[model samples]
Target: MDYKSYPVVENIFGISGLNANLANILMITVCSAIVLLIGVLSARAIQMKPTGMQNVFEWLIDFVKGIINNTMDWKTGERFLGLGLTIFLYILIANLSKLPFVITTEPGHVVWWKAPTDDPLITLTLAAIIIVLTHFYGIKIKGFGGYGKDYFKPVPFLFPLKVIEEFANTLTLGMRLFGNIYAKGILMALLVSLGVSGFFGFFAAALPTIAWQAFSLFIGAIQAFIFLMLTMVYMAHKVADDH
Candidate 1:
């Protein structure tokens, strides 16, 4: 089995989980805990005019809030602000982790705890969560009847098509993030196989890899934004009508 093709799963309290991939619930749990702890501690990093980590998180919160406001009505978008911000930071850090030094030579060729986004399962799971959230909120805002009527869309006769589109959109959302991030891993694997410095690798080989890493970071953020936007869009659509 190509280690690359298979999840880096490790047994954890009975369940086999991803070893190097973020699919490992344990790893994600740890990461999430760290983020939460930091967020809690830094909630008031700066009282007057925040500095350091507090400043960064505040700016991030403001940034996510702005995105929500611009893309969705204030009333509708407020609910998703935390999710959007969490997704952005979780994914941003995950992607950026790839740019740093990696340990490599681990059980599953692990390195630098590579960004969670680099793992498709993680992205797909997140996509599923987003879809679920959209539906949950959709049903919450609109009654069960309204949620069901959403499938019929513009007209009752369009039920089948509407259902297909809704299903397709959710799958596509996951696939979009998965495909790009997974591709990054593939590229990195190829480069590492060449036994050279990475673009950011202190060694000379890093020259080329750095450019790719930068591009990956850009892609990561864009994907995160798109995912959040789609979440809001889906929610808005669901709540907008009862067919």
Candidate 2:
């Protein structure tokens, strides 16, 4: 099947190309809204003995804390507990949200929503943000001059290599997510094409699609965890005194 990207803002702004990844933007917005709503609702009624939404949210927070503690000391990592929690939950939601087949009015054009992580722009933007924050925190903790001197530690010639390493990390972190999620999208599209080809093809692809969906959920969760873990590692490397 031919592919055509949708631009949710195209009509309003008449922009395309990088601006055309609007569906991913919309999905990210939707996921953010849902996450915020869940947080609000869960916190609306707090009890000494937590249950249901409160319990789940607390558990999630502790789980994220565990992840942070694994990478950094509790004192330093606790400050980032919320950030880690938000990234993990937001990415997890974004990843699995694409599993449902969208109803579309036209072929090629994306439906109202798509997985934000499936878009490199979205993933790379997130990766860049994470790296930027790492630099910020490094400076905040170690002073601007201290953080700057890190690039040339043990030798003055390693500055360029260090810069290249940061760029590579950002590219790899983002592309890894986009590649996996995009492959899942392609698999879904192929299965859909198969289902539309003939009665026999429909039967042949139906079960496989369902099976793949289950497997994709694992992939999605793992990617989210990997992203979260890497983010923590990058942050730790920047802020830690060990250099």
Candidate 3:
């Protein structure tokens, strides 16, 4: 798997060396637009009795509510419903996008799309955003003094350890998602390479590719749920009175 970076425009205008993966960024943007569209369509016309897209959206909202409610009370959790819903929908769409057929000349050179979550920069940025938001809320709920005091909890000796834990959480959260999705992409690339060998190789690759894609779908859903659940849990730790 070629893990090398693809320049955003190879060169923007006349200048060179603007580091960006435009393909991944575009995929993320497209996924975000799709999620937004679905949200709008779902609520375009509210029915006296919900049906179709409305029902599906309602169910998903309820499911996200449950994640928040599990970690904290509905009162506090409901405040973050938008974040939870957006993360789940966007990640799900991005993850599954790779499953569709791609007419590419080579593996890993998929032009139009790649899973956004598979990119470490995207995943880490998301993790940092969630972590930073939690800190902001912590400061809001607990005074600055109260929030700072958390690092010295149990014993003053553990202050450094507690501080380091924050960094650890950010890295683990981002890398876990990136590693899983990236591995799936790499596996798909490998399968594609095998299929290109010859006619026999193509048939041999078919079943395994289908199986792995199915399993990758399951992993994607589970990862999305895990990310949402972890976000809520982190928020709970920051906002709950007991913490």
| Clash-forming residue pairs, model 1 | 8-19, 9-17, 94-115, 102-112, 197-205, 197-206, 198-206, 199-206, 199-209, 199-210
**Ordering by TM-score:** 2, 3, 1
lDDT of 1: 0.67
Candidate 1 C-alpha lDDT tens digits along 1-243: 233333443333433663343334544765677668767877845677788888878888888888777666777778777888777767655655554334344466444355566556777787778778777888898789878876765688988787788678778887887787777777765555443433444354466566776787788778777877776677667665421
Task: Please give the TM-score that candidate 1 achieves against the real structure.
Answer: 0.77
Per-candidate TM equals 0.77, 0.88, 0.88
Q: Please provide, for model 2 over 103-184, each residue's C-alpha lDDT reduced to its tens digit, 9 standing for 90 to 100.
A: 4445344355678887788899999999999999999998999899889987999889999999999999999999999899
Residue 79 C-alpha lDDT in model 1: 77
Judge candidate 1 at residue 195 and give its lDDT.
Answer: 37
What shift in Å separates residue 87 of candidate 3 from its native position after superposition? 1.3
Task: Please state the error at residue 40 of candidate 2 in Å.
Answer: 1.1
| Residue 210 Cα positional deviation in candidate 2, in Å, after optimal superposition | 0.9
lDDT, ranked from best to worst: 2, 3, 1
Q: Which pairs of residues have clashing backbones in candidate 3? A: none
For candidate 3, the TM-score is 0.88
